[model samples]
Target: MTRALLLVDIQLDYFPGGAFPLAEPEAAAVAARTVLDSFRESGELVVHIFHVATAPDATFFVPETPGIGFHPAVAPLDGETTLEKHQPNSFIDTGLETVLREAGVTELVIVGMMSSMCIDSTTRAAHELGFVCTVVSDACAAPDLTLGETTVPGASVHAAFMAALDGSFATVTPSASLV
Candidate 1:
């Protein structure tokens, strides 16, 4: 089956010192770079997705901000396609489905930042859209979140989301296993 590496929102805003930093962003980026290298060497399709927040009240990822740009480690090469997204689901109005269909991609290997948000959204959407998905657990990270009186740790949030997505939406694996 044809496979594509969907690098979702591996951007500056999610990295250290950016607008919205995630836990262990550097480590996730390093793992993603390794998977990216494998995909490139295997001659598989690679698509980079970046989120651009258009809401007026948004604090990060506003258009023209450096934080919206891809991180240096996982930056798209000249021939790779880059998709700009306005929502958590990368395929929403992004022509991502069309691109993947045209490339004959049946399986997607997804890895990126904000595991509880973009990664979760994209994986579920892809599964509902009929594409087989595999998410690299160690190659994605999320920041701690507060709900009501409980403050959840980033690592816990990341693990919970990965587990949630594993069976139904996608197969959760590690970067080393894929590489």
Candidate 2:
């Protein structure tokens, strides 16, 4: 099966010191970089989904902001393609579907930020659009924990999001076991 890794919103804005930082997003970012590098070594496809806030009165992810660009360490190579998105779902206002269709991508290995939002949205959308999705458990995150200090970690949020999508939307797996 033709597989493509759908890297969603690994931008600087979501990093720990950025404008809208996620909780421990750096961990997922590192894992995603490793996954992308592996895909490059194995001659696989890596599609980057970059979220650009196009709203006139934007609060977060504004393109002009320093945070809008991708994190320094997770740069895309020449062969990799970038899809700019205005909405949470990468396929929402972008050519993600078209690009995937053109590449004949049957199965998607998904990873990136905001596990409960954009990540979850696109995973389900891919399934509805007939592409099998495998969400990288350790390569996604959510900003808010369950409650307080005893709340769940962002990684757990990642796993829960994956589990919630089971059977109906997609399957979930760890980045190390993906290949």
- For candidate 2, the lDDT comes to 0.83
Backbone clashes (count) for model 1: 0
Angstrom error of the Cα, residue 114, model 2: value is 0.9
- Model 1: CA > 4 A from native: none
For model 1, the local distance difference test gives: 0.95
Q: RMSD (Cα, Å) of candidate 2?
A: 2.4
- Cα lDDT tens digits, model 1, 32-133, are 999999999999999999999999999999899899999999999999999999999999999999999999999999999889999999999999999999
Q: How does candidate 1 fare on TM-score?
A: 0.98
Residue pairs that clash (backbone atoms under 3 angstroms), model 2: none
Error of 1 at 152 (Å): 0.5
Per-model CA lDDT versus the true structure = 0.95, 0.83
Enumerate clash totals for all models, in the order shown: 0, 0
Number of the top TM-score candidate: 1
